[model samples]
Target: MPLALLALAISAFGIGTTEFVIMGLLPDVAADLHTSVLTAGNLVSAYAIGVVVGAPLLAVVGVRMSRKHLLIVVMGVFVAGNLLSALAPDFGWLVAGRVIAGLPHGAFFGAGSVVAASLAREGREGRAVATVLLGLTFANIVGVPAATLLGQDVGWRATFLVVTGIGVVAVSALAALVPYEPARPQQSLGRELRAFRDRRVLLVLATAVFGFAGVFATYAYLASIATHVMGLEESSVVWVLALCGVGMTIGVAAAGPLTDRAALPTAYAGLGGLAAVLIAFAFTAHITWVAMVMVVLLGAVGFLMTAPLQTMVIRFASDAPTLAAASNHSAFNLANAGGVWLGGVAIASGWGWTSCALVGACLAIVGLVIALTAGQTAARRATA
Candidate 1:
């Protein structure tokens, strides 16, 4: 691996930490802002909206800039957002800060992926992308739990300040390590839009939107599941959270080689695995040890699509990889919003917290069907 990958991974770590750490601190944020947990969750939705809107927006404008410069600019945006969050006066400002912070989240990853893929050896494309995403997986395991604990002790505001500090370090590392490349021939915005017109591209993105949603719906309320459903002390939730992160790290690391060898098949298998795990979780939540194991499984299966989905999108849009790549991030965060909303409705409709797993299961199955259809369609085209 190139040392430049280390820079990108560090930036990914900072970005992922800011993205997920809020989930663990949701209860604290709600209490401090004099609001309900549900309302704090709305802030999460706000951030997702920012990601959905910003990914393509930034990518289109940034198509002409060097990836290194673009990465720096977005990291700057992240730092500024965290600073705003740390200084937020109340619920409204905090929501605004989240939105601001989220605006750069997807664009950074999109650009970083393109850069990482460009840097990889001929047969190792998937490994490079996975290396970048590892930062995100590790953030779940180490960063979120640590930040959550820090928030519980110091204050949620202080936690954002800490994230801001991480962002600063990432910015420095990125500037020093990521080499500059001249901008490639620019694709027109219309050419970029054409990527969306391809049915295969649309299907692949749809799969991500639905498939990824399954996990987010369940994860959106994980804190509730930990404390209210499992009857664990609030402090112990951090360990379970870390355990899930461990599962994600392992799963994503495994996904790289699997994706390099078999992209869509791996995707189908992963989607099926997610559905099975969620279905099992619905029945197992009553047992503490069983539920703990399920958390790891859920994280593992849920993230299996992370690199494959990106690869599939880039494959289809070879003419406009950056735009297609950035748009996939939009797909991901849209799933985040959609899943959170569906999970909230399920819980509010008198379904127990465990029922979110059922919701996730259904979504995963739907995504599996889509992946299978795409694979079959491509096979037919190849045979014909």
Candidate 2:
């Protein structure tokens, strides 16, 4: 693996920390900003909205720049966002800062995916892409939990400040490590945009959107599930979350190797496992040991779908993948919002928290169906 991959991973660490740390500190942030928890919750939505709006746009804006410079510029935006967040005076400022921080996230990952693919030997692209995703996966285990602890002890502002430092380091690393220029020719804006028109590309993105929805639906209500359903102490929730992160880390690690050999099949296996886990989780929620085991399996199986989905989309895009690649983040964020909204609806309708698992399962089934269609279509095309 290229050392440059490490730089990408490090930046992912900071971005992941800032993105999720807010979830754990919503109450503290709401208190500090003198706003209701609902408003504070909007801060999280603000960041997602930024990613949804910015990923393709920024990829286009940064499209002309060399991949190395674009990555650095993206990191600069991330750093500035965190710095502003650390010093934000009120809720509005904090939301602005988070939006700024999130804007470059998908673009950076998209560009990095392209660069990593270029750097790797033939047939090793999946592993390289998985290596880049490892940063995001690892963040759950290390960055989010650590930041949560820091936020609790000091203040949420300080947590963002720490993330700011991490971003600075990442920027420095990118500057030192990545090549000054990309080896491949740049794709035109029109060419990048055309990728959306491809049937396979659209299907893959849909698969990503619906497939990951299951993960988020169950995940969004986990804290509630822990306290109300499982009867765990509030203090224990963090560690259990951490345990899930451990599963994520493990899943990402295995995904790299498995995806390298069989990309679509790996995704099928992951989606299947994830769907099964989510359904089983609903019933297992009240069982302490079962819940813990299920959480880990859920994390593992959910993230296992990531690298293959990226690989499929990039491949489907063919001549111009940058925008399609970047847009996956948009798809995932949309899934996040959809999953949470549907899960909330379930709970509000007296379906209870466990209903989220079934909702997620249904989503996974939708994704699996799409993937099957995509696979069969590809086979026909290949033989035709």
TM-score of each: 0.96, 0.98
Query: What are the runs in model 1 whose C-alpha is more than 4 Å off?
Result: 381-384
lDDT of 1 by residue, 102-151 (tens): 98878888888888888998768888898999999999888998888899
Name the top TM-score candidate. 2
- Top model by lDDT, which number? 2
Question: What root-mean-square deviation over C-alphas does model 2 reach?
Answer: 1.2
| Runs off by more than 4 Å, candidate 2 | 183-186
How much does candidate 2 score in TM-score? 0.98
Count of steric clashes across candidates, in order: 0, 0
Report, for every candidate in turn, its global Cα lDDT versus the true structure.
0.87, 0.88
